[model samples]
Target chain A: MKRFWCLFFMIWPVLALYVCWIAPSMGWWFPFTGPTGMKAASPLGERIDDLFYMILYITTATFVGTQIALGYVLFKGAAATDEGNTEKAWYSHGSHNLEVIWTIVPACVLLFIALYQMDVWAQYRVKDSFPSETKQGAIAEVTARQFEWRIRYPGLGPDGKPLPLMPEPQPTDLYTVNDLHAVVGKAVMIILETQDVQHSFFLPELRVKQDAVPGLDIPVWFKASKSGDYTLLCAELCGWGHYKMKARMVAETEDKYLEFLQNLTKSQNYDGVPETPAEGAPVASAAE
Target chain B: MRSKLVALVLCSGMLFVCGCGRTEPQFSYREGLSPRVQEYVRTTVDEKFGTPHKIRVWDKLPIQAHTALATVGEGSKDNSLVVDISGASRPIEPGTEVVWVGGTIMPRGSAPVTVEAFTKDKNLLSLVAAPPAAPKAGDKIVIGPGQTLTHGRLLYAEHCQHCHGVAGDGQGPTAPYLNVRPRDYRKGLFKFTSTKEGMKAHRSDLARVIEDGIPGTYMPSFKLLKPEESHAIIEYVLFLAMRGESEFQMNNLLASDYSDASVANRIKDGETQEKVIEEFVTRVKEGEIDEEVNQRNEKMIADWVSAQAEDAVIVPKEKRNASDEESIKRGRELYLSGNLNCVACHGESGLGDGVQTYSVTKNTDTGKDNVEPGLYDTWGNKLKPRNLRLGMYRGGRRPIDIYARIEAGIKGTPMPAFGAKLTEQQKWDIVNYVLELPHELRTPGTGVAPASPATKPAPVATTAH
Candidate 1:
């Protein structure tokens, strides 16, 4: 029984290592392949995954080494108690070099991870890194309110004027009070706000999540890679109806998106006249 | 043994430390349901008519049937109370008169009502009635129909004042719960309907909404009021909202006139306040202020209200039948086509997935995208639109559900109220089309095969000059 117990203890770490190393890479039990069913976004997600594997391998090795040392100590201590070979058990001071090696190695590993992770974080969060000039551009505003997310898109009218955007500091520009949609392939900046409480905007496939803060603006950017229906869900608990605040988002080709927008604009009846800028007049800058 | 004892003690200490985390509040269905139902009844009734004097059960036993008993006046000894029956968990068989007696009657300006309910077999169900009324400092002003101002003010204070504020500033306490906050009553821009086309919401559109609360929001239905009461409330709410909006516009105008340094200096010298007040009074008396400005603001607000009314028009009682196969076919074609784009947001398969599923963008109004989730039904429940293939609609399997949604557009979301855009016939056709989407798009030999027809593209809209 004792021998069996020892063998079970010896095999557990190896099994755990094997499962951890092979499971995700093999995609045996993974769900939700990120966006395009791909492994990572940017080179950074892949790099981080690589670093994760490296740590896993190193830790597995260290665990094996420790197990071996423990086994050896247990065996040696038990065997040294024979009466004929009885002697004062040798007491050795802990090795300063060993302690130094373990401490320095872990410190170096942590430093490497910290430095590498900063770049990944910056790549995802930095607004400047956005590929705003791409053909399939990002032009959508996400408004998170109590238990619901309201999306707005600037639908162009018949004369080809884009509808006014909202949360525009000028009270007059609070146009399209609620209808939110935008044309495809246009660089759209979404100004986020909350109506009653805090909520979050999470797009899993786009790998973007931003909090919907009331009395403040939290901006997020993402370009749809394909024309498909994606889901928008609240990631925060606003109230009892939090779970029901689900909506659909459609990313279409430029022509199709524009066509959709035109249909919406034509159908909607606005009370105010369209605010047209004078020809050759200087355009007002957005609020800083 | 000593080491083992230490290890046990340490493990127990760790467990205690871990257990110190805050306990999460558990979801309670019963607690949430009762209050929601009660609030829904109260708000709906009050909005429909003025506050009721005594809302009680009608009978002595079998307390299933409840009624709203409102008194006509403060001190009339006659049978001034009008009792209207409302609410039933199960369908009430025709001619079944379920009543409960011994229910306490609370006066409009008095203390609480304590009532009890018993089964036909004498078992008790519940005893609680109305909550106690708070103390009032002044004698209640009795306003009759002829006194429109007094009547409007009394009604507004009772119903609209809680949310619209005493000054009509839309800063109501309950305003916080609404998704699309309560109409500031001061903006006068009703987002739901339009009246410019000589179209008005049929009486039922307003009454039904007051009866059958908006499905997914804080707006609860006031089903307890008689038809007359509901009409009165609607008028009262509208009057308050418009009056507030006009006042707000006037204030803005006055503020603009005092902006100049000389005007400011005069105000600083304590003369400007009286001058501004006099000017305001003169303008009110003359009523000849900027006609264009007033027209523009009025039109803006009128147009919004018109849109809401248009959206709220459910199919007339006559057009709800599923008789027109051709219209339904056309509706199906439209649903599949680019126009109405229902398939895009709902889904091609009618599973609510077209091109835009799970796509995240910011909301134009609130500025936060990543919206919570999509369309739900009444009952504050989450219900995805039926997969067209499945042919099931929780809102009722009738063609009217599809029609009303297409026409009115679901309130409080991205669903643009489509009433103003779609013709009444087209709306019905769309409903027929939605009902047929699942079956029409289904595979052949799947029990019920769709009638074969050529796929038609959406008609291109000619720009209105």
Candidate 2:
């Protein structure tokens, strides 16, 4: 009975590992967000995904090893307990060698990983370290307010003003609410701000999330390889109306991007004379 | 003994495996909430549409466990019989039996009994063979204070609950933050319904709102959602609207019937007043007075249900008046005219800051009005009349959309229908005036004179206004 009990206990650690890690990896249900996270949409996202898998592999191995060791300890101790040999180890001396080996091994492995990940981290976070090919001046400034995103683009004549509806944006600044338009294959930059509280400008597929803190102007950039309409969700719990704080990111060919801006401009200004700009749209900056 | 122990271990091991093998039971529409809500199970007097209802739970609670039981009365839109947890908090799994105040649940076709749970508790719940014929004011109406969590409720809680209140009152957690508040369905009214007349916001109208959201508001188009899922949401929204309407009616009826003045009128003097008051109270409790209330309720429910009748709309008799400057000039003259009264609600500058600024008055029944109103809509919340200076239209900004808004007044709001009062040309004139209000207001100095044909700027196709 004792042997059986010990054996059952021995397998529990293994069972847990199998259920939490192995089963999920085998498609039983890991990636609890559903299936696999949609394939990353940008080069930066792909790099992030690669880094994620590398850490996952190392951690998974360590987890399986630890659980197996736990099972082995229980399995070997079963015989002595069953035979009524319940004796305590009196020797207080710890195995310094074993401790050193375990500690040093993990430290070395982690050090190597940290050193290897620096480049990817810098490429993503450090503006100065960004690829020269993707560099572009601020395309638009997005302001986050209660339950909506107010986006402003540079308009013609150095002043953000409406141009006639045409296939081409008259190099004039434009503005829109709850929608962002950008040309695909070209790196785009946006200056983000928050009118009221904390908001995370999150693009899940692009693997981009930036906090828009009140009293701060944070710049974020991304390039879309594919042209399509994607979602911009407020990842932060800004307020009760956060769920409705959804915006559409329309990434397409240059022509389509211009077309979208033209239509929005018409809607924003309507008449040649300026009326109240699209609700939350900001007044054009003179310097820009 | 060893063999016995092995057998016991084996038996337990097998039992454990068997327990792990069975998955949570899948619910068929018959066995669960989705199909039940999809069908006309609980309906208003019209029976053409089902009564609206939804489950209420705190956002923190896991949506799966809670369920609701509604005591659906035949032919009457009774949204009473609310079921909720009493105590012992824990995550409930499938098939948990909930006992109600009116009696333990009985299977379909079981004979109805006068259970103490029903008569004793004001909930007045009866699942089988309809309910007791008469319901008095004293009878507790329980239109789902709680329900067995249904699939529809789950969907609504996830998608719509944050903005639309748990009961569809449009007072959700985020409702306060929005400049333009969402529609409160308690009045069972929607602003832009599909048809007008018999059924308010017909089935298609609800579907349209759900699919293509209202413009210039926080509402978004949910066209990406699957057909079945959107329909489920539609049904759930209706459930909430109907439930809210039922509660609204009940409150109104009780307040009027049991007012202090009415009670005083019942007893003219102290002498013989005790006996007379007792009789009056008895009359109220005996369901005698309910007959009249119920008749009124019938008309109210029918009016709500028939809001979608085809004839309930206003259409232009002739083609839209040309949007030329001359036409715009004609439109502007009528806009500032005293008869139209556009300047009263919409100010001189058309900034929506007119004479009705923050009109505060006491609610007669409650004698307390916390709400300060620029203008109160059907939901009793402050509504900002659209700033005509900004050509942002809530219903839509299209020519016909704007025209229709003028011809027929926006339902359940301060906007009145001009179709009856004004001719088509007159209504068209109003639409043109509204559309051009922003332009005229923007260039204040460039008014009336710009009406000359030769002096007028050429039409710009890009000019959305």
Enumerate the chain B TM-scores of all models: 0.41, 0.57
DockQ of each: 0.01, 0.05
Candidates in order: C-alpha RMSD to true structure = 22.9, 16.0
lDDT of 1 by residue, A23-49 (tens): 767775322443445443324335545
lDDT of 2 at A166: 24
lDDT string, candidate 2, A199-267, tens digits: 989877677888888876666778766777677879899866677777777778977776675565455
lDDT (10s digit) by residue, model 2, range B182-296: 7787777888753432236766667756655665577765555666566557656766665566545544554343334544555564435456456645765796655754665
TM per candidate comes to: 0.36, 0.56
Work out candidate 2's RMSD over C-alphas: 16.0
Clash counts per candidate, in order, are: 74, 37
